[model samples]
Target: MNRRRFFGFLQKEFRHIFRDRRTMLILFGMPIVQILLFGFAITNEIKNVNVAVLDMAHDDVSRDITNRILSSEYFHLYQNLHSEKEIEAAFKSGKVKEVIVFENNLAKNIYSKNIGNIQLIGDATDPNTANTIVAYTRAILLNYQQELNKGSKPPAIIQTEVRMWFNEELKGVYLFVPGVMTIIMMLVSAMMTSISLAREKETGTLEALMVSPLKSWQVILGKVIPYLVLSFSITLLTLGLSMFVFHVPIRGNIFLLLGEVLLFVITALSFGILISSIAPNQMAAMLISMMGLMLPTIILSGYIFPIDNMPVPLQVISNIIPARWFISMLRDIMLKGAGWSVVWKDTCVLAFMAVVFLFLASRRFKMKLR
Candidate 1:
């Protein structure tokens, strides 16, 4: 490779990036906005959720249970209902997310060693929140039961205490940080690189470059180097914000994290190059990157949803998504404080994908020139 020519090409690519305000905004602004949005605004942890109470028994036990649920951070007692008829209206109006119905002889049944029924009705439109609300309500009731059985020996209760490892508090930020980082990296490295290269083809600059002294590999490298730097910077910015602002800890070796970051960057950029080689224009490249890369990264990467929970076909499809492996590595390293031993398989998978993608991209890109 000619050093002067390569350096000149790199400089030109950097200039192109800096000259565009929109590109700069996307490179910088989007990461921060998305991170903050998911960190704070989008969360699974229930807080200040509204609920209506149907108290058929206005006894002390029923009143105490209602008071306990309201006092907790998870639920807010929106209103009291005398009958179950108001539940449908409460849910339909979108005023309350849940309704707690206490049976008529709640206190008597509990005192007389009979099963005291309490029905928890939740709006299942949001299954996740509904499950969480039910869980919290059950926890509160369990606490109340423990209080009642303070001195007495209760019957054999199979108490299952779920301890969430790595993330004890169950903060949504813990779940979102790694996924958000994957998305930002994919967009910056893969999507942006594809668009930038496609713009060259659209503007007829690629033809000039093709006929120039610069080899095909050098030209591809020139286009990639700028996005690589930008993507790395974004990675650092995202990690810093997550650590400082959101307090998501990085427990593994810093070098390991950086190594994985570099691997995934190259992997994503290879995918971008492959897309750019096939797409005739920047618009097509952008759409392919957004729809093809972004959607799979979000859906199939086990970011928001667990892959195991998906159907067999979708679970198999998820294996091909590079983000799935990268995000898995991130979680293992960051949350579990795992070492290379735990994550080496993932690293190998990414490296192999990067090689395969780059090979395909190089061939397709060369074919395009002919």
Candidate 2:
């Protein structure tokens, strides 16, 4: 209620932040480092994938397709397998991702039936890579067929229309940005706030504040408001890196995106406050936040892995991770160009989390300070 006191409190909080070199580095340096690391280190694009070719036809058409697959930047022809028995060895050696087998009569089959069956045997150990290898091989074969058709008289050409939604280019950075933001926001808001508050408790400053005119809520607000500002700045830094450095586009409304970010920050801050309320010391607070919050956010938030592919139990557990809702909301906004109508459910879920966390943190705070 007292404007002067609140402004002084804010000034004091800002001093606490700026005076600490480690805190300043975390507030500014960590976001940039993390964004760059994740943006570049992890990627989905496959290149120079080793492949084995079994050319039974050994004819011009078969050889041409083999050359095409070999010359493709996506694949490298590792070796030529003599027979069916050699296919197993290539794959087992872990050097070959795919074995392209040309059937007995490829040129004859194409000339007569207008179709040729080329079996693609993939190493199912890495399903994603195997799938990509098959797709690229298919494209090469289709191109060859189209080239042959142009020279000859074909009765019909079945054209297949392909459409890639959200991420047309399929750059891994597009997926990484939102997920990185989720982890960073959680780290900055909750982990940082909890540790800061626990430090106050360890130092006896919290007791001094309790004895002062500051209400318990005011004390908690003073601690987190600085983090709120810092977290927003980190968000901006992340978005800038995502857009300018990585070229990840924001397809939806910027204001809406930021609003959702703020909501998530508040939720994380509240959760942090609750952690601080119970933690006996700063070390304990940091450990708890790292293990309890960061690990779950990374593993269960659908950041690096697809939720649909997770087991039924893990999928159910993922529902409780707030980052799950936040990441989906971000993807919907940035990738899908979705408005409130599309992402309203995710937004509502985040809002509910914010309310619940705030309530629990407040209750825990009153109990602790009393």
Candidate 3:
């Protein structure tokens, strides 16, 4: 009930939140640093991957396909083996991530039967990347098939020429950068904020804030405004580094990007506020944030796996994840150079989530105050 005591306590509480080194690092530093690192680590496509060629046939057709793979820059030939025995050695030596084998009758088969089989041996250590590499190898063969089929014009020709757009190089790291940034921001903004706010409740300070005349809105604003600024700055910092240092592009409207970022930030902050309302302590808040939100954001966000490819239930689960919309928006704008016209659906979904989260947070906080 004492006005001076309450304001003084609120100021002290704000200082504690800001001064905590771990929280500052998590809120301000991780978004930029981790996102950039993720950008480099988390790509689904493959390029410039080391590959070995076992051309037992040594024929013109096999030589042409080899040249094509080398020219595509998706492959760097470390060895041109003379025998099948050399293939096992090349694969085991770890000198190559993939091995392309041309059978001894490659030329004859192509000329007479119009079909030549190619064996692609890929390293399964990095299974995701290995799968993509194998896909690329198949694409290379398919390209050759199409090039041959064009002249003879075979009916029912299965030709596939894969063109990886946006990230033409299809480097896994480049894809990881944005995704990591998205994930870290979602975690830090929502969960970290929630845990920090919940700490005061566990310590009995939040009750004091509720009783203060500073107004509940001001107290909530004071707690969140600083972190929001910090998190938003981190987002911009990550984007800048990804664009300049990593050579990533901002292919969409600058204003739209900033606007979406604001939406995402507020969404996270609101979620944090809501968590703080429900959680009785910091540990519970942290656990709820990590398990309930962060994991889903990463898993369902289509950052680590393609959501479209997931099972029906998981795909349904993805609908509730804000990161899912943000990731889709980011890809549309960042990779596809899509405009608001194209990304508006995702933007609307994010906006709706923000409204829902803020509404819940506000309602829960009001009830808590009483």
Q: Highest TM-score among the candidates is held by which one?
A: 2
Q: What is the descending TM-score order?
A: 2, 1, 3
What tens-digit string does per-residue lDDT give for candidate 1 at 1-370? 5899999999999999999988799779988998899777775668999999999978888899899999998899888887778889999989798888888878877777635778888777876567667778878988888787777564312132322212233456787788988998999899989999999999998888777788889888998999999999989999999899988899999899999999999999999999999899999999999899999999999998988889999999999999999999999999889999999999999999999999998888872464
lDDT of 1 at 49: 95
In each prediction, how many residue pairs overlap at the backbone (N, C-alpha, C within less than 3 A)? Answer: 0, 0, 7
Instruction: Estimate, for each residue in 36-93, the C-alpha lDDT of model 2 and write its tens digit.
Output: 8766665555789999988898887788888887887999989999999998999899
Please tell me which model should have the higher lDDT, number 1 or number 3: 1
lDDT value, residue 279 of candidate 3: 88
Give the per-residue lDDT digits (tens) of candidate 3, residues 218-322: 667766776677677777887888888777777889789888988998898999999988988999999999898988888888998888789999999899899
Residue-pair clashes, model 1: 0
Tell me, by lDDT, which candidate is best. Answer: 1
TM-scores for every candidate against the unseen true structure: 0.84, 0.86, 0.76
Candidate 3 local Cα displacement, residue 209, angstroms = 2.2
lDDT of 2 at 178: 93
Model 3 global lDDT (CA atoms, 0 to 1): 0.77
